[model samples]
Target: MTPSPESVTTMLYQHDDNGALLRTDLPFPRRSGKVRDVYDLGDNLLIVSTDRISAFDFILPSGIPDKGRILTQTSAFWFDHLDVRHHLLSTEVPEALSAQFDTEPLVGRVMVTEKASVIPFECVVRGYLEGSGLIEYQQTGEICGNRLPPGLKQCDRLPEAIFTPATKAEEGDHDENVSIGRMIADLGSDLALGLRKRSLDIYRKACQYAESRGILIADTKFEFGKVGDEVVLIDEVLTPDSSRFWAADDYQPGQAQPSFDKQFVREWLSTCGWDKKSDPPALPPEIIQRTKAKYEEAKKRLTQSEPTL
Candidate 1:
């Protein structure tokens, strides 16, 4: 059974004053990413989503309270609902490590997954014009070699969703958008085509369901991995951190639309006069609270309505 959002928030903040699990100390081989700490557990992996948040490729010092739990639970919701082969094995922490580590911090934010050879590209699907996609369209009338219809306004829904793949960048670097042909050249025709089809299929289904729940998934990126000969969806799926989610009732196409992700943090950072090069400044308490509310609202909206997929 899924716990209520209020209950989860209470549990998360009861112990820590800041209400952020910034990091985890585990006795396993670990690789810490921008927001998640991944520990290798022999055949499987223990992925712990921390409250750490990043923007403009920099990890911010302040974290949104309960952000990790929201992300993890949101991904778990999709993993259970979406009809796709995915890497999620379970959300429960393994029994062996229960005695060694404090389980309080890990609850609702842990995923035990099968480790697979990660595909080096981010499979991006866009149903709307925004972000880098909009900038590219304005300049060349295309995005990642997909020729978009001319005169498309900002946030305008595309006639059809398009698959745009990007090369995964190193830590603290940006992922470069590349053409589909480039994906085929590097990953071969069969594999590239397969990934594109899978990504689009998932996006279409998710878009339909999310729209019904009063949210529009403007765009989202997916990661896939190989387990022996089979390709499976890997990493977080359709979470606010990985996807651009907009309030359906409030959306307008002529200009930038309000989002449910870390856009507030980005907006704050953009105007705070901090150079994008150096260490990022800490977010104010109000920004943190507002950001946390946005993420919570998204999780509540998407997970509350269960539809036949």
Candidate 2:
């Protein structure tokens, strides 16, 4: 059975006094993404998942407590469950860098991974019609340049999962969906075809597992990178931040479904009366608690484990 949110302990990193860690000043060279900070360590990279959350292109002022650890743990679970080759080397902080900060906060929130030449695409697969796909389909009867059968409504399950790849955007920009032909033009047919097949296979395997756990994977995005000559999975996999996870018991075909992802945060942001052009306001305490519950619930349900009380 799934565990209650309160069962998990709130252990904050000493440096994370604000409940959200906005940045890390590690001694090594690093680059920051939406939610992760990647540090270069020659052959390997250290990725630190922060409690920081972003919505509608703005990183909100407030952060959810324990959000980083939950995301890291969820990704680690998938990396272990899937049989495919991936970039994770160890979740352990290298002994070499132990003096950088309080290692306690880093535990369960950092990964030491093999560095690769990352592919520049968001390999997305959709099992249900929703999100940008729904918007595109409503307008063009197509998504990612592929036409589907007529009359599909929002959140309707597609006859089959579809591979719709998008180009990865720079920080603070939106990712733009591109056609297979465009992918071939940019990445060549052989590589594009390989990514498509690998993405669909992984999605199917994950979907089956999630369904058994009472979660529906509506859609998800994946990142890949080249280690030497082979393309291997890189970055986080199948976590709530990268996937749309709906509760199987509450799923409805014609309306937006309740989710175990940041949809809750996004929904609240959409209706909060803030203009998209200005800085996003800090999330209210209620929103933060509710959002954190969803992430924790997703992790517990998928792993089929009780919280570490």
lDDT of 1 by residue, 1-309 (tens): 988856654543332346677777676898989999999999999999999999888888888878988998899999999999999999987888776444766878899999999999999999999999999999999999999889899999999999999999998788999999999999999999999999999999999999999999999999999999999999999999999999999999989989999988999999999999999998889899889988988998999932211
Clashing pairs in 2: none
Cα lDDT listed for each candidate: 0.90, 0.87
Task: Judge candidate 1 at residue 70 and give its lDDT.
Answer: 91
lDDT score for residue 8 of model 2: 22
Candidate 2 lDDT: 0.87
For model 1, which pairs clash?
none
Off by over 4 Å in 1: 1-17, 305-309
Per-residue lDDT of 46-95 in model 2, one digit per residue for the tens? 99998888988888878888788888889999999999999999998788
Question: After best superposition, candidate 1 residue 166: deviation in angstroms?
Answer: 0.2
lDDT of 2 at 253: 97
